[model samples]
Target: MLVKMYYNIKIIIFKLACFKLALPADGATGEHEDTSQPRQVTSTRRTQVSVRGPDSPKIRGEVHAPIRGLKCLCTNAHSMGNKQEELALLLADTNPDIVGLTETWWESTHDWAVNIKGYRLFRWDRKGRKGRGVAPYVKKQYTSLPNSVGSEDGQTEMLWVRIQGGQGQRDLMVGVYYQLPNQGEELDWEFSGQLVETVKSRDVVIMGDLNYPDNCWEEQSARSDRSHRFLAEIQDLYLTQEVHSPTRANALLDLVLATGNDLVRGLQVLDHLGDSDHCLLEFTIQLRVSKACSKAAALDFRRADFNELRRLVGEALRSQRVRELRI
Candidate 1:
């Protein structure tokens, strides 16, 4: 019985050994199991991506001009919309340093000033109750004068700014004015006279939608020369006429006047009148400072000094010794 049990245990052990050898090297329990080599470990890191909206456009660098200084624009503010944006883009293409908008019907609470990329804004609107007002958009890089001097009518306003020229000298002062369309002839005359007087003391460029026809004599003689006295005042002040309409018919009422003999070397009538009733006036003045005038300006000739010099010269001449010395 013991011999028979030993033989049965040996047979069982042999059967278990045979079963283990029949299995695959990976010890798979099923016939359909995958025996291919293991896939190589892929070490990948998760990355983040940034996205921009569709409306954003890439910005180009600053524009270059033959002349460097303050460039001015005068446009009547009809309203702010797609038309207005087109106008702004048009002005941006020209790259004016300063822009004066008249009849701007902007609420004091809203963003009255817009970003021209590298520009700052100085805006003044009449009281909300008041009908209309003026605003100036100046380039951010330039320095603006502290005070903007003007008349009380609110029909016209001026911006005073010291512009550094490419020659590295203070060469320009820009004054932007906007007068109402129907401000009586007397008031027109008065305002024109005031503008001329104010700008005469400085090197100025006066640009605006004066609302008076360039050919006042031809179009509205009934209003008379008094209504268009601003043009006369500008001409009388020795400010060279940089831009004036060529034909009385379909002519632009906008004007650009430059002080002294610097003639407007270039004038362009931009094709953007669809946005506003008035066409865009663009002109360039070649400013050449006179050395003699500059020297006179630098001299410290105070009123007291002038009086003393005259008195001393008179006394020295009266004295016989001084006269003899000259003789």
Candidate 2:
């Protein structure tokens, strides 16, 4: 009976091992098996987020806008004189991208911004009774930064503007300056030195009735060095014409200096506005990117050794024997 029980137990253990082998492993099961629960398929559907390009449809209007050239006008309107009507007419007809008006009597006048159609105005007021100021009128099509600096004596005004161009964009820092009349050499030197020191390090255009002409005025002969150095540092946009006037005479006072690329090509003195003492100065600037220089090609000239040639000639002469047979 004990032997029978041991044989039965061995048979049962073999059967159990076979049953365990027949069953499926932990994660491995045949597709046809209905005994196991169906696996929940975790979806891997990639959420495709649409990305927008720089020239996408949302910004198509701005991308499609045509790039245009920028035209800047600079003038010293002679604040002592009342010539608003004349200035308005001239500005209206000229239609400059920006107009820099210097020596404006801002303290005396209540209305600073003289609104012209298709143009936006910016002005800096002067201190009490000084009558020195600068104003810039930009076209409505373009945008400008908020005014930062104004003049107290109505002699200087600085404004910043951003202009979009075909190739890229440009920042314009324009200054309208009107030096004190009859300030003498010392004052002129001091003022010019200040201006040079202030603007020499930055990209800027100093334009307006500088009062100091390129040529030595009777008043400026003593301080000619200061004026010359100042003019030399900044490229004179009015080089071709001695004096930009309706009539011919050498009196170049109003000027424009381009700090970046010498984009200023020409400056034309427009027809005088009524009886205003100062004339309007208009400038034409062409924007362009600088190009890289190419390398030069090597020359292929033959070089001869004089000593070698001489030695070869001597050897040839020595080798050749002039044999003369006497007849």
Candidate 3:
């Protein structure tokens, strides 16, 4: 019985081995069964990304105050007589405190034609000639007077005006000049003399088409002798040329010169007017006008008219009751 039992045990072991061998291998069927723990599948298409650190700064916009001061607009209206409507439109749009125009092409015949409303016109029309004129329009509220100084031959056209400032502001001397491209040194000398005298008195702002393309305003140098002398004079007077960009075809012919750095701000070269080749210049004159004082008296309760006030109130109440009853 012991032998039979041992043989049966061997047979059972052989059958178990055969059954284990018949089973599939671990990866032969293209399947995985990880009972211990799930495996992480590696991917070759993964991309690396970066994140901002805690020290990174947050982006924001800058805040600035609104510009409040005297605004001025200047342009070279090659022939302003024919472009009056365009100038009018521009004045209406900008509403500047002062307007300066060079090459106005005005004569005695345009006396009544070039006047703009709400502005006191100070013009220097070319005498015995056709082209090359300068005009400055000061607002009517300010007291402005023409102080023109030019040659008898009308070679140097300079329109000088003294503008009375408001209560705390200083009076300003504004000059509008137009130098002929081919003008001789005599005209330049005359203009420089007058300019020096004007600057010696009060603060001055000179705006116009000076026709000095040879000037390098940034470097404060000039190629031509004429422009060199002019630059030297400007530097001696401690004046600053505010316009940087080109106003005409690849040349900064239009200029806005001021006595002090604080005198001018926000200088921009705008589009051309009419058929003119030069661009418009707009800037702020860093000056303020005081508000006009009104003569208004406040109510005084010490001298009360209570009896009349009560009577009016009673009448108004009775009238309101009558109207409500009628309704």
Give the least accurate 10-residue stretch of model 2, judged by summed lDDT.
52-61
Clashing residue pairs found in predicted model 3: none
lDDT for every model?
0.50, 0.49, 0.72
Question: What are the per-residue Cα lDDT tens digits for candidate 1 across 1-327?
Answer: 445544654554443332222322221112231223222212122332111111111111222222443455566655543355665676778787667666565565546445456766665566646445556677755434323344555344444444433221223556566666567765566566555555533456766666665344333232445444654665567766555463113755566666665545466655443456665665664544322212122222232344544555466456676455553
Best by TM-score: 3
After superposition, which runs of candidate 1 have C-alpha atoms over 4 Å from their true positions? 1-72, 81-84, 150-155, 164-168, 214-223, 246-251, 261-263, 289-327
Give residue 61's lDDT in candidate 2 (0 to 100): 13
> Which one wins by TM-score: 2 or 3?
3
Candidate 1's C-alpha lDDT?
A: 0.50
Q: Give the worst 10-residue stretch by lDDT in candidate 1.
A: 49-58
Candidate 3 runs further than 4 Å off: 1-68, 148-154, 288-327
181-279: candidate 2 lDDT, tens digit per residue: 445665455544444543422335656666655444323232567566555534332222233343213566776656544556567777555555667
lDDT of 3 by residue, 1-327 (tens): 445544654554443333221333221222332344222222222332111111111111111122246789998999986799888888898899899999998888887778888988987887777888889998866555665454445457888876544343445678888888879888888988887766763568999999999898889889988899999998899899999999999999999999889889999999999999999999988753333333443444445555655565456446654456552
Clash pairs, model 1 backbone: 119-140
Query: Using Cα atoms with residue i matched to residue i, what is each candidate's TM-score against the true structure?
Result: 0.56, 0.53, 0.65
